[model samples]
Target: MTPVLVALEAFHVLRPLWLGALVPIAALWWMVRARRAHRAAPRDGLAPHLRDALTVGSDGQRRVMPIDMVCVALALLAFGASGPTWSRQPDPFVAQSAPLVAALKVTPSMTADDIAPSRLERGKQKIRDLLELRAGARTALIAYAGTAHVAVPMTEDPGVMLPYLAGLDPAVMPEEGDRPGLALDSAQALLSRETGPGAVLFVTDGLDPDDVPALSAANVIILSLLPEGQGDRGLEAVSDVPVIAVTADGADVAQIDRLLDAAQARALLDDDRQPWLDRGPWLALPAALLMLLWFRRGWTMRWVLMVAAFLLTQPASQARADGIADWFFTPDQRGRLAFDRGDFRVASEAFSDPLWRGYALYRDGQYADAAEVLSRVETAQAAFIQGMAYLRSRSYRDGVRAFETALLRDPDYPNAAENLETARAIVAYVEEAQEQSDTGEDRGIGADDVVFDNESGKGEETVISVPEDGADALLSADQWMTTVDTRTGDFLKSRFALEQNRPAPSAEADAPDGDEPREDSSQSQAPELAE
Candidate 1:
């Protein structure tokens, strides 16, 4: 198709409802204009001379510019603000194939020549076919005789599984029994690392009815290589899963193809697919240029200026009523830009939106401020962030409270429970340290004494004693506390200072103050408490 035709075909309006609202606005405008004209008409009983004096400056001539021009401009502005869009361009798909584990039975029963080749060899062939059909899928192979063992770990390359398939022998198995349950368990273990949908394909003669429920949690597909007379009715009765039985002559290859097709369709349907691109902003430039033409000095310019001023002066919440702010830089968008550049102070100031202001403060290392800001929001995410802020600021009791609140809001919130335990441990240690200081036993402290290595899951304790020299030993015990506290406080205080002193946002010139606000000396003090 021609480019123009294609563009025309793709064109669509995002907010058609806004266009409907324009009808009532136009009607109101017309009614107000008529009312003004009617009120300005001279009284019927007035003398001609008196009327002439009252209308002294009136030229009795029509306006040079028609009111229709203003109406047309308003209509164009409305259409542009409604978000006109066109031309969908396809984005590259990030294909994610579900992991598949093929569990093959290596018992003596698999050696029976029910198929043209032995049952074991046929089962191996089917597994190879499945891997080839599911190209790019993460696959694993498990061999089972008495117990199950992972013959191959999960890998994208199907060829890695071929070596293990050829090496499968019943004699190699240390025990002899049919335990499909153990094989399913091994498959689940292999798939635990993967975060996508998973399936377990059983290539065996049959499975125990009781063991079928264990594989019910995952997608299960059974490929039976039993003899023609040995149907899979018993297995089907217990498990509501797909079972494809292959004879010695291999008459059910088409059924295998159908099953593979269905599986691929399901995967594509459930995967997280990206949405179409929005082209609404492409129309904004033309709309702006058209409005600029109406800025000529005249009554038309005066009317346009009045409308523009009214829109600009409206409060932020009211501006969003007509989506006017959507066409300009929103506070959240400005905050995100500043945050990305690591200018968190400016980001916090820019984020007038209550939802994101707390996060900006947290990133700025204003932990106490962040906790206060987030308390009002009171969502699971807000509570979690508040917990982190409190914890980093050495408010262990408050941190525990915030984390518990987060868990109450959402029991499955990640890391809330773990961090709560850490906070409790810190609180206990703080009490212990206070007791020791009161008893005059351990006056000096080391860096390891205060900091807990949560990542390594261990705490280091190291205390430095005072020298036995006569003059140094005579110093008060309180002096030792001051010296040790300074060393530990330096770590956090320096990091806080570094964060506070980052360069201002790139668009600082456009801010209300035209520059970043300077901090006073009083605001730079570091606390003596341990962190």
Candidate 2:
């Protein structure tokens, strides 16, 4: 279980280390040969028929004895030297004693009839279940609608937290908008009050962006409560924190099991402090016994049995090939085909497997990974694949460099020049885009409305307007407006007041009426943003 034990177990597999073991085998062979030659000399003068005969002398020496025993002993010695082992690891049943923090989301559309009992209600039920499952651990509950507010501070008894959570409804927080990032920050702050290694369970419909990176950085595990048919749509992250998923629409037990399996996989990778036993000593014993028997039974029919045992005990070389393939195409190989077809998502999933991660990254505009994958390739096709990955990832400089290097080895190559040009174009585009976005003057803010809160009473009335035809372009253009204020910004109090009055305008405009209101043509909200 200790680090030293693990290191020692791994060291036994080293060729140089195993070679030292061969010393004992060599000594055994030398001793056996000396004994055999001495025994054979006395029997040489006997008749040819009797020379090979088995005999029991009055001095208690036996000949032509049990070959099976000798073979079995040799096999044991060989097996011991090879260091076979079995580990009886402890059951991972003990639970953590740390307190937990739960962040529950209550959004406006949570009242949608799509889910039975509503998404918010069902989420509360699951949280209740999770709390019941947590033994006596303390937990805090946070309820957020448009914004977040702590429902229950950390408490050891779920019973104490249940009443506070029971009062939770969509109306608990003012209807501003769902912002999981802010909610997560509040939950994290609540969790910081507890002692020991605490965790957070954020149960939300995927209203949030891929918060995996942020949540993981916060050292909080995320358990996504996706509605049925929802999957990670557009997210990219390399997070150490584990994510478990459960569907709102009665998730199949199999899906839960998969989630658990994923969690376990992540734990194995991240929880290095977990115990692992040394199995080397157990294996060495049998290998030593097998080698002893191998010496006792000189080239005989018993080798057939030894071969069978070896075949049964040791996996064939083909297994290594299959392992490579599995690592490359884990869960599915849809990603590789998708990458080939220019589908980035599938390629990304396929890249999750270590074997293909590099390739996936390359196809997804990750040139660094492509170069790494290309470096690992052993075949000509791999070199070409690596080159293409580099090209697609927009590493035109690297792609051109790689192509030139490969061409020197094989002239008149196919497809290299075409990829080279593509990479060059991507490089040009990247440079241009970078320059365009960076230049202060190039970003046209005149077309973009500069909304300013007139807190500072500057007494000049200036009418700076654009033509109606160019109004949209002006609004859409990149612009930054400076604000002059004596007070530090605080929107929460104003937002709370607005929510209480129900004065928030509907995202969709009613009819355009001169008396009703002048539509802010410059500040139009997107349809989804209205939600």
Candidate 3:
């Protein structure tokens, strides 16, 4: 959806009743105008010269009056009170910006040097610029040639996405063809799993004519990697999707940003769970300027000054007592403001909500208090926080139990399994050390706070949990994950090959001939590179 269409669909008044005030205001203006006209009526049979002499100014009859200003100001205020809005608040659990999935074309054509370094490198740079523009927003990467695959999963950290993005190569793809249709499907699948609506960005030089159908169906925005004045003729057929031509400057990326915002606005409008965002305050600006005219000579009213004085003095008095903050913000709201500013200690002090308070406490390094507060919350995220709190406090057993609870509640909770294993290993290491120590008391450095010593010098050679070179045997599921020496191209090739070889339910029906021996599926294959 474009922003114009979204605004057209979403623009509405929250408090429609306030508009009724306009009726009386209009009537009052008309009555005042009629009364003034009657009072200013020329005397019966008066000469034109005498009438002109009686008027102090030539255009006095047409000059703006106090009633006109009052009516306009009141009308503006009434319109503002109606609470006009065209967008809503962002999802509380998600960032203000929408999630984005960038589907990049890793093909031989993208390596062409029509412009600068190459189309592929330029696309990569554009993606980097986009990441900078949309920091803290979740984004994913997809690479497509003959088939599409996720190069990187959705993540808020640009560092994680950038490494995989840089590693993508046309040679890494399992097959060779421009299959953006498949890429769109992959992008959709990734977005389908998101809690809120997201947008897909296609960074490619051109698209196959047949791919237009798939492109037309979705709200994908295309960042044309093709040089200026050059484009895929097939894309002109796409009516709904916006194709932003590549620019040397940031204009193209700015268009992509707008499309992403439109997606978020659409989500806000469609979700009944959230309320329409009130934009009533925007109307106050014009109304305020109109009221300023009342300060002129012969127009100043005692009530206006009284109201202005009261509004001004009231805030100072409220500031002294903090009553204004109390009136405008809840405790949790204040805590969230503080939390966003990195003042976790103040956030912890202000938060009455157990989860936020506990999280704030944890960030502030009050792990003991965090664990105690978080234990009252039953959610998986709360359990995860509590578990980390325990780990920080050197309560390995408690940390293990908390992690186990989190896994039981939500097995997919990120990093929960790895932390659980670490806690368990620490506990095991402590027990083993206790058994080996001759004094039967902790004496030397162990994991975290646990210590063991060989005072007797009789204990067998002790095994360390993780090596000094930074092995994750004490943490993650697979210790070899960090040790893998395989290049990203090789890793992606193997991953895509596995998917390509997997049997599909419609394999026989879709194949040209089920009885014939299977041949190579790649439309074009690059020569194998030497290791």
Question: Which candidate gets the maximum TM-score versus the true structure?
Answer: 3
Leading candidate by lDDT: 3
> In candidate 3, where is summed lDDT lowest over 10 consecutive residues?
522-531
Clashing pairs for model 3 are 444-452
* Model 1 root-mean-square deviation: 22.2
> Compared with the true structure, what per-residue lDDT tens digits does model 2 show for residues 1-531?
333344344343212344355566556655654564466335566885675465434232343333434444554455445554322222211112345568877776666555667767777777777666553446777666666655666665679777666666665567657666666766666655333345566666654446556765764545555556666531225246555555544443233333433333333324434444335456545544544554454534455467867889976555223565664444445555555454554676655454355545543566666678656655433454466655445445566566665555555445445444555555555555444444333333344343322223323222344446854634323332333332211333343345346543321111122221111111110000000
Q: Number of backbone collisions per candidate, in order? A: 0, 30, 1
lDDT of 3 by residue, 236-294 (tens): 77677888888899988888887888777776677676667788887778888988888
Relative to the unseen true structure, what is the Cα RMSD of model 2?
21.2
| Tens digit of per-residue lDDT, candidate 1, span 393-454 | 87778888898898899887665676777777777766666545444344575323444323
Pairs that clash in candidate 1: none
* Candidate 3 Cα misplacement greater than 4 A, ranges: 41-54, 302-317, 320-531
TM-score for predicted model 1 compared with the true structure:
0.36
Which consecutive 10 residues in model 2 have the weakest lDDT in total?
A: 522-531
Q: Give the TM-score of candidate 2.
A: 0.34
In order of appearance, the predictions have TM-scores of: 0.36, 0.34, 0.69
Q: Mark the regions of model 1 whose C-alpha exceeds 4 Å error after superposition.
A: 1-93, 232-234, 247-273, 276-531
